[model samples]
Target chain A: MATTIIETGGLTRSYGDICALKPLDLQVPEGEWLSVMGHSGSGKSTLMNLVGGLDRPSAGSLMVGGEDLLALSEDGLARFRREFVGIIFQQHHLVPYLTAVENVMLAQYFHSVPDEAEARSALERVGLGHRLKNRPGELSGGEQQRVCIARAIINSPKLLLGDEPTGNLDHKSTVMIMELLKELRAEERFTVVMVTHNQEVAAWGDRTIYLDDGVLVREERTNS
Target chain B: MLFRILKNSFLKRPKAVLLIFLSITMGAAVATAFLGISGEISHKMALELRSYGANILLEPSAVEGGFLREEDLPKIKTVFWKYNITGFTPYLFSIAEFSAGGKKERGVVSGTWFAKQLEVPGEDSSIQGIKGIAPWWEVQGRWPEDAAEAIIGAALAKRLNVVAGGDVTTIVRGRSQQFRIVGVVTTGGYEEEQLFAPLVTVQSLLQLPGKVSRVLVSALTVPMDDFGKKDPATMSKDEYEKWYCTAYVTSVAKNVEEVMAGSRAKPIWQIASAEGALLKKLNSVMLLLTVLALGASATAVSTSLMASMAERSPEIALMKAVGADRFQISAIFVGETLLISMAGGVVGYLLGDQLAEVISRTVFSSTIVSPLWLFPTAIISALSVAIAGSVVPLRRALLIEPVRVLKG
Candidate 1:
C-alpha cells in the first residue's frame, strides 16, 4: 500500500448555531480516487474545503503528506496549497483575460519560476495543445474545462481535487473530462478527492463516501 | 518574475498606474521646489545682510564724564580675541557742497583711512580703497590718493554732473577747496549720494583733526536665536554673560560698542528674521505637499489594486485551493507591487526633477536643481504606497474561500 497522504481525525466546523462538519474521521491512501457524494447542504464540500486548506476546521487533527495541517500557519498552508495540491472547479476558473496557455503558465508561475515548455506539455496532455492561445471566453465549455485540467496538473501537485468538475459539462464533455482525469491520475499517481452529486460521476472513484447533514452516512469501495 | 507580473499588470492597466505615478511625482516635485526656494531665500537674505559691509560698528564713546581716545583703535587689534577680528576701515565725514559746471550738489565729503590715501598696498590700487570702504559698493573708477582728489558716489555725481578726473569745487565749513573726482561708488542706497575724498584732504579741508564720528568693523557672526535676541537688562546673570560671550550678532554689536568711542551699534536682525520666517513657512508647505502627494498616490494605488483584485479573485481562490500558504500567496502579489513601485520611483524621480525645475522657473522665476537624495525618497514613498494601499485588497483576496468559490 502507498503512504497515507490524507488523514483527518475528529474534524469539525461550525457556522454560528449551525455545524457544517461534525467529528469526521477519514484516511486517504496515496494515489487513491475518493469521491464524496451528497445532496446540497451535506458536509462533502466542507470536508473538501478543510482537506484543501481553503477553510480551517473548528476542531481536528488533519495531516496532508505527513504535515500537520492544523499546526501550519496561514502562509505555511498556502505553500502547501501551491506546491502540493491541484484543484479543478465545476465553473472552470480560468482567468478570462489570459490565453489558455497563459492561464496554465500562471499555475507554474505561482508555484515556481514559470516554464513555458512545461506548461505547453501539460496542455498537450489534456488535449488542449491546439487551443493554447485561445482565451477562456473564446473556447467551448469542454475546451475551457480541459484548459483548467491542464492548469491544475501543470504544477504536478501531490493531490488533485475536483469539485463538481463535470457539473456544467454536456454528456460528451463529461465523458471526455472523466476519461482525461483517469488517465492523468494513472500516469501521475496523485491522490484524488472529488465531491459530486452525480452518482455516475462518483462511480469513477475507487471509493465513495456519502454524507448528509454534516455526517458521513455510508462508505463503499469498488474494484475497476 | 514578480517584476514581469508587475510590468504586464501595469501594461494591462496603464491608466491606473499612471494616476498613482503622477500623484507621487507631484508630491516629490513640490517637495523639491519648496525646499529649493527656501534655500535660495536664505542665501539671498545672507547676501543682503552682507551689504551692511560689516557685521560690527564702533564710534566715539562719551561716558557721562569720559571720552574714549582715538588711540583705543590699536587696543581693538590687540583684544583678547583679536584673531577673530579680520579687518576694519575707519571713515571721517564732513558736510560739503560740490560745484561742477555751476551745478552745486550738497553731499557729505567722506574720506577713508587707506594706506595710500584711498589706495591699499599689495591690492590693485585700481580696485582697493573707498571701493574697499563698502566692499559691497560697486565702483567704476580708481580711488584718488593725490591732494584735492576724491571719489564721488554715482548718485551725487549724477546730481552734480561730475565724472572722474573732473574738477569740482568743495566748500566745507566756510572753507573753499577744489578737488578732482577720480571714482564713482554705488552702494545701492544713500551711500550712492555721498562724496568720497582722501582722509587727510577731508581733515585739512574741515580743520578737524584726530576725530572720526564712527568706525564700521565687518566681522563674521552666527545667526541669533531666541536667547541671543533677549535684552540683556531683562536677562538673568548667567544668560546675560552667555549672550555677551557668544559670537552672535548682539554680542558682536556690544563688543564693537565697548571698543569704540561715542557711538551705538545694531545688528542686521531684520534681514535675519525675514530669511528665517520665509524658510520656516517654505519648509512647512513642502512637508504638507509631500503628505498630500503621498496620500493621493496611495489612494490611486489602492483603487487600481482593488479593481485588479476583483478581476483576479478566481486566480487567488485557485491558489488557495491548491494549498498555497498565505506567505506564498502574498509574495506573488506583494513582490509584483514592490517591483512596479521601484520602477515607478525611478521614473518618478526623473520626471519629478524636470517638474521641479519647471515649477521653480515659472512660479518663482528661479532655477531649481533637485538634490540626489530624492531618488531614494521617491522609491521608498512609492513602496510605502504599495504596502499601504494593498492591505485592504490583499485581505479581500485572502478571504476568497476556495471551497465556496469552487462550489460554483
Candidate 2:
C-alpha cells in the first residue's frame, strides 16, 4: 500500500458566481503521475493551482504531504510550495534578467542557502549545462522550458505540477521535454500532477482524469 | 542572491536608478551646501561682529580738548573684566597742513599706536594697537617706526601727491615737521581723509605730552539680554555685580570706563545688535531652505521609485512565487536604495563643497573651509531621504499578489 501524497475532499474554487472547480474528491498516491485533461475553462488549471498552493480554494479541505494546506497562511503556503511542489507553466516563466543558472539558484536560495554547484548540476541534468549563462530570451522554446524544469526541481521538491508545460513546443520539442520529465521523475521518484488537453501528453502519465463544466466526468489508468 | 538580483535589476534599468540617484544627489548636495555655508557664515559673522571697527569707544570725560593720561593705558589690562577685552588703541587728533611735491591739503592728523606692546603687573604682556582693533583698514605699506615716519590716508595721499616712499611736510600752527610716508591706508570712512602717525611722535609734534583724545576697544561679548539692557545706575548691588560679571558689550564698556581715568566708555550698539540680529535671521533662513530642499528631493525620489516599482511588478511577483518572503523582498529593495543613497551622498558632498566655495566667494566675498563633520551629515541625510522615499514603495512591493501578477 502506497501513502497518499495529495488528498482533496470536496475541494472547490470559484471566482465570484462562476465556479471553476466543483466540490470534487481526489487522491494521488506517492510517486504517481496524475494527468488532468480538460477543455478551456474546464477547471483543470484551477485544480493544479490549488494543489500547488498558488491560490486558495473557495471551499473544502486540501491536504498535501499529510499537512492541511487550507490552514497555512500565505507565507506558509509559499514555503509549502517551494519545499514540496514545483510548478512548470506553459509560458516557462523565468526571471528574464537572470541567466539559466541564476534562475535555478533562485529556488535553492528560497528553500535554504543557494548552492551554485547543485544548481549547475540541476541545469546539467535538464540538458542545459552548456547554456547556463544564457538568459531566457537567448534560449529556444524547448531550451527555455528545460531551464524552467531545472529551476523547478533545483530544490528537489517532493511534488511537480505542470500546467501545459509543453503547450507552446513543437512535436519534437514536446516529446523531448516529456522524455526529460519522465527521466527526471524516474530518478527523483517525485509525484507529478500535469494538466493538459492533449491525449498523447496525457498518455505519458500513469493515470488520467477528465474534467468538464467544473466536474470530473471520467477517469482512466494508462499502461506505462 | 538578493544582492545579485538587485544588481542585475539596477543594471538592466539604468535610467530608473539614475533618476533616483540624481534626485538623492541633488538633495544631499543642497543640504550640505546650505549647512556648510550657514555654519561658516555664523562663524564669520561672530568674528566680524567682534571686529566691527570697535565695539567700545572711549573719550575724555571733561569737555573740549581734555585728554586721558597715556600712562593709564596699561590699567585697561588690569580691569575687573580685563580678559574679555581683546584690544584697545588710543588716538590723539590735531589739525595740520600736509604738503608734498608742491601739493597741499589740510587734514586731521590722528596719532595712534601701530602695534604697541603693553605690560600690566600680574598679567601676561599683550600687543594692544590699531592692528588688532581695526583689521578692516587696508594699508598698502608698512607702519611708521620713527618720529620722522607717518602713514597718510588715501585721500590725503592723493591730494598731496604722496606715495609710501615720499616725504610729507606737516605744518602745525607756526611749527613744521617733515615726515617720510611709510604707508598709505584706505579706511573707506572719515579715516581716509585724516593722516595717521605714531602716538608718541604726534604728541611731540603737537607738543601735548602723554595725552590721548580717544580710545577704541574691541572685546568679545555676549549678546545683550533684558537684564544686560538694564541701566547699571538703577540695578541693585547684587544685580549690578551679576551684570558686571557677564561679558556683555555694555558690561565690558563699563569695565573699561572704570579702569581708564577721566574717560567715558560707550558700546557701539548699532554694529553689535545689528550683527546679532542679521546672523540669527540668516541662520534660520538657511535651515529653512535646507529642510525645504530635502523635502522636495525626498518627494522626487519617492515618485521616481514608485514609478519603477510599478514597472517591475512582474519581477517582484516572480520573486515571491520563487518563495521569497516579505523580509527577503524588503531586504533586496531597501539594500539597493541604501547603496545608491550612499553613492549619491559622497558625490553630493564633493559637489556641495565646490558649490559652497562658489556661493561664499560670490555672495560673501570670502572663502569657506568645509568642516569635517559635514561628510557624515551628508551621508546620513542621504540615507534618510532614501529610506523615507522607499517606505511606501516597499510596502507596495510586499503587498503584490504573485498569483495575479504571474497570471499574465
Candidate 3:
C-alpha cells in the first residue's frame, strides 16, 4: 500500500463530435511500472497524450502527484512538463542538428539554465558517451532512442511517459532499451507509463492495461 | 550566449545570412555616401562664396561728392571686428586704350595693389594685394612686379591681341602711361575684360594720388536669410550698421561704410543666397534618394528573412515547444540579423565612399573627398534595416503553434 502517484476520474476527450477517449477511472501507486497495450486507435496513445499534458481532456479530473493538472495555464503546464514530467515518442523527435549531448542539454535548457557537463554525464549514463557529438542522422536507431531517453530523464523528472520507446528498434535493441529503462527506474524510482502492443514488453511492467475502441476492456497484474 | 547563438546560426546558414547582409550593406552605403558628400559640398560652396568680395558694397555717399583716400584703409581695418577682417583690395578704374601685338583695343584700366605680382614676407614675389583677394582667378602668366607693369584680363587680352611680356599704353585725363603686360587673369566675370596695374602707379599717372573710388573686402561672414537682406533706407541707423557689420552681408557693408569716407559698400550675398536656395533643393533630392534607398533595403531584407523563416519553421516550433517564450525566440532571430548587418555596414561604408568619389569625378570632373562620420552612419542604417525588416517575420515565428508543428 504505496501512496497513489496518479489519479484520474471520468476522463474523456473529443475531437469535434467524435469521442477519442471515453470516461475512465484509474489509480496507479507510486514507483510502479504500468504498461498500456492496445492496437492502433485503441485510445492508448490518446490517453498518453492527455496524461502528458499534450492535449486537454474534455471532462475529467487528473491528479498527478497531488497537483491538479487541469487547472494549470499553458505556461504553467509547460513548467510542469519541464520540472515534473518527461515524455519519449516513437519517432525519437531529437533535433537532427544538435549532437547527442546537446540534445540532452535541451531538456535542461527548458527546466533551467542548461549545464553542458551534466548533460554529458546524462548521455554517458545512457551508454552514449562515445557518440556525444554525433547527430541523430549519424547515429543508429537504437543510439538515437538512447539519446532521446537521455534527454527525457536529464531533468530527473518525477514521471516518465514512453510512447513506443523502442517501437522501431531491432529485437536485441528492444531488449537493451527495456533493460536500460528497468535499471534506470530501479535507481531513480520514478513511475513509468509505457504504451506498447507487445505482450512480452507488457510483462516487464508491474501491471498491464488493455484498451479497445477508446474503452478500457481489461486489466492484468503480473508482479506479486 | 545570444551572440554565440547568433554566430552559430549565421554560420549554419551562410547563404541566407549573406543575402540579407549584402542588401543591408547596399542601403547603408548609399545613405552614407550621399549624405556625406552633400554636407561637404554645402560647406565647401559656402566657403567659396565667402571669398567672393564684400556682400554689401559702398560708394561715395553722393556719386559726385568724391572718392575714398588711402588713409581710410587703416580706419576700415580698425572696425569692431578688426581681427575678423580678412583683407581689402582697393581699385580705381579709368577707361583707357591699350596696344599689344600691333593691335589696339579699348579696355578698362584698373589700379590694383599688385595686380598679379604675388609675394608674402618670406616669399620673393608679392602675394598681395589683388592676387590674395582673387584666389579663384586662373592666371596664364605672372603678375606685374614693377610699377610700370600690368596684367590684362584674358578676355581683354584676346581682344587687344596681347600676351605676357607685351606692352600697352593707357590714356587718362589727357595723360598716357606705357606699361608692360605681365599676366592675363580669368575671373569668369566682368573682371576678365579689364587691365590691372599697381595702385600707386595708376593714381600718380592719373594725377589723383592716394585716391580710390571703392574697395573690395573679403571677410568671413555668417549666412543670412531674406529678411537680413532688407533695404537699408527702410532701417534705422542703429539697426542699419548692426545689420551691416556682424560678419553677415549687411554687416560687412555697414562696416565698410563706417570706415571709408563718403563711400558705401555691398556684399556678394545676393548671388550666394540664390545659389544657396538651389543647393538646398539639391540636398533635399539627395535626402530623398537616401530614404528611397533604405526603403528598398528594408524590402529586400524582409523578402529574404521571410524566405529563411519558411525554411526555419520546424526549428522555431522546436524552440517554442522547448519552453522558449516569444522574446527569447525573437532574440535568436533578430540577433542573427544584427550580427550580419554589422559586418555589412563596415563593408558598405568603404564601398560607398569609393562609389561617391567615382560618381562625382565622372559627373562633375572634380574630386570629392569623403568624410569620416559616414562609417558609423552606414552601420547604424544597416542595423536599423535589419531590425526593421525582420520584425514581421519574427512575429510570424512567434505565432507558430508548437504542439501542432511538433505533432506534425
Candidate 4:
C-alpha cells in the first residue's frame, strides 16, 4: 500500500495575465520517480517551484506529506522546504565562496545542527570524498553537480526536486548523474519529481507527464 | 557553518568589507577625537580661567598715597561672605633701580604674600598668597621666604642680568637694600617686568609700614545675572543684603570692599565672562561636528554594504533555497558587520588618542589626559554606525525572492 507523498488539486500559478500553470490535478506516490516534460515557457519549472514550496500558487490546494503548503507562511514554507524537501537546480547553485564540504554542511545547518561527519559522508557517498575542500569554481561541471546532489540530500529529505538538474552537463556526465540519482533514490527511498525536456532523461523515471501551453497534455507510465 | 560562510565571504570580498571597516573606523575616530578634545579643552580652559582668576581687584580709593592697612586683611576672612573668598594677596608696588652683576634696570618692585598662613580669631587659619591665586605663573626656582629674598620677573632678570641665587641691590628714595634672588618668574604679562619681594621688605624699603597699594583676590563665584549687576549703594536695605549674600563676582567684590577700609573693589569682567562664552561655543561646535561625522560614516557604510548586497544576491538566494530563514540570513550579515565595527572601534580609539594629543599640542599648546570613558564611547559609536548602516541592506537581503534570483 503506497501512500501519496504529494497531492495537488487544481493547483494554478499565474504571473499577471499570463498563466504559467493552469489548474491541474496531480498526485505523486511515495518512492516514485515522476518526470515532467515541457518545452520552454511551459509550466514545468513553475510546477516544480510550487511543489518545492519556493512559489505560491495563484489558486488551489497543495499538500505535501499531509501538510497543506498553501496554508504555510513564508517562514513556515522555508522550514518545510528544509525539513521535507531537497532541490537540485539546473545551474548547480552552490555558494561560490564556500567549499564543497561547507556547502553540504549548509543544508544540515539550516535543517538542524550541522554535523560535519554526516556532510562529509554524504559527499563521499556522491563520489566527492577527495574534493571536499574544493570550491565550486575549482571543480568540473560534473563534480559541481555532484556536490549539489550531496548538499540536496545532506538532510535526508523525504522528497527530492530537480529542475533540469543535468541540463548543463555532457551526455556522459548527464548519464552518470542520473544513475547516481537512481541509486540514491533506491537507497534513501525518497520520491523524486524532475522537470526536463529530454526524452532519454524522462525514460529514467517511473512515469512522465507532458505540459504544453500551461496545461497537462499527456501522461505515460514507463518501466516499473 | 554560518560563521564559516561569512568568513569565506568576507575573505573573498575584501574590498567590500574593507570599505565598511574604513568608514566605521573613520567615523569612530572623528567622534573620539572631537569628544576627547572637547572634554580636554574644557578642562584646560577651566584651568586657564582659574589661573587668570582674579575676579576681585581691590585698590585704595583715595587719590593720595593712602593705602589699605595690613591690619584690615584679617577682617576679610571674618566678612559675611568669608568662605566664598578662596584666597587674597596684597601688593605694594614701588619703582626702584635694580642692580646686579654691574647691570642696572629701573623696574617696578612688587611686595606680595608668598604662601603666607594667616589666622583670624575664632575662625580656621588659612593660607593667603600669590601661590593660591596665580597658579599659571611659571617660576624657575622657588618663592621668596626671607625678608632679604626676592623673585625677579623673567624680563627684569634678563635686563639686570640676575639669575636665581644671585644678589641684587634695590634703591628706592635713596634708601637701598641688597636681596638674594631666589627665583625668576615668567608670567607672560606686564608682571614679567617687575621684581617680587616679601611684603615686609617692600614696606621697609618704601618706608610705608602696615600699608598695601592693592590686593588681588581669587574667589569661587557664580556667573553674574541682572540682580548681581545692580549697584549695591543704590539698592534698598533688603536688596543690598541679597546682593551681598550671593557668590556672584560682583557681590563677592562688594563683600571684600566692605571689609577693607578705603578700598574700591572691582570684578575682573574680561576673564569671568570670556570663560563662560568661550566654553559654551566650543562645546556646541564639538557636538555638532561629532554628529555630522557619525552621519557621514553611516551613509558611507550603507552605500558600501548596499553594493555588496547587490553583488551577493545569488548567494543569498541560494541560501534561502537551501532553507535559511530570515533570522539565519540576517544573523550572517549583521554578525559580520558587528565584528568589523568592533575591530574598527579599538583601532579608532588608538588613532583618535594620538590625534587628540596632536590637536591639543598644536592648538592649546598643552598636553591632555585621555579620559578612560572614551574607549567605550568609541566602541558604542562604532556599533551604532554598523547597526544603523545595516538596516536597509538586511531588509534587502530578506526581501530577496529565491525563485527570481535563482532562475538563471
* Candidate topping TM-score: 4
Off by over 4 Å in 1: A1-3, A222-224, B1-4, B45-274, B363-407
With a 3 Å backbone cut-off (N, CA, C), the pairs that clash in candidate 2 are none
Candidate 4, clashing residue pairs?
A: none
* Winner of 3 and 4 under DockQ: 4
Question: Candidate 3: TM of chain A?
Answer: 0.98
Task: Give the chain A TM-score for each candidate.
Answer: 0.98, 0.99, 0.98, 0.99
Residues A10-108 of candidate 1: C-alpha lDDT, one tens digit per residue: 999998889999899999999999999998989888888788877788987899898898988877777877888888888898766577888887878
lDDT of 1 by residue, B103-200 (tens): 98888887665543223333323222233435666767876768778778888899988888788888987897888888787778887888877766
Tell me the TM-score of each prediction against the true structure: 0.70, 0.72, 0.69, 0.73
Question: For residues B1-33, what per-residue lDDT tens digits would candidate 2 score against the true structure?
Answer: 877788888888899999999999999999999
Which candidate do you rate higher for lDDT, 2 or 3?
A: 2
Off by over 4 Å in 4: B47-274
Model 4 reaches an interface RMSD of 0.8
Query: In angstroms, how far off is A145's CA in candidate 2?
Result: 0.9
Q: What DockQ does candidate 1 score?
A: 0.40
Cα misplacement distance, residue B395 of candidate 1 (Å) = 5.6
lDDT of 2 by residue, A1-224 (tens): 99999999999999999999999999999999999999999999889889988889999999999889999987888788878888888888888888999988888888899888988999999898899999999999999999999988887889999989999999999999999999999999999999999999999999999999889999999996
| Per-model CA lDDT versus the true structure | 0.74, 0.89, 0.78, 0.90
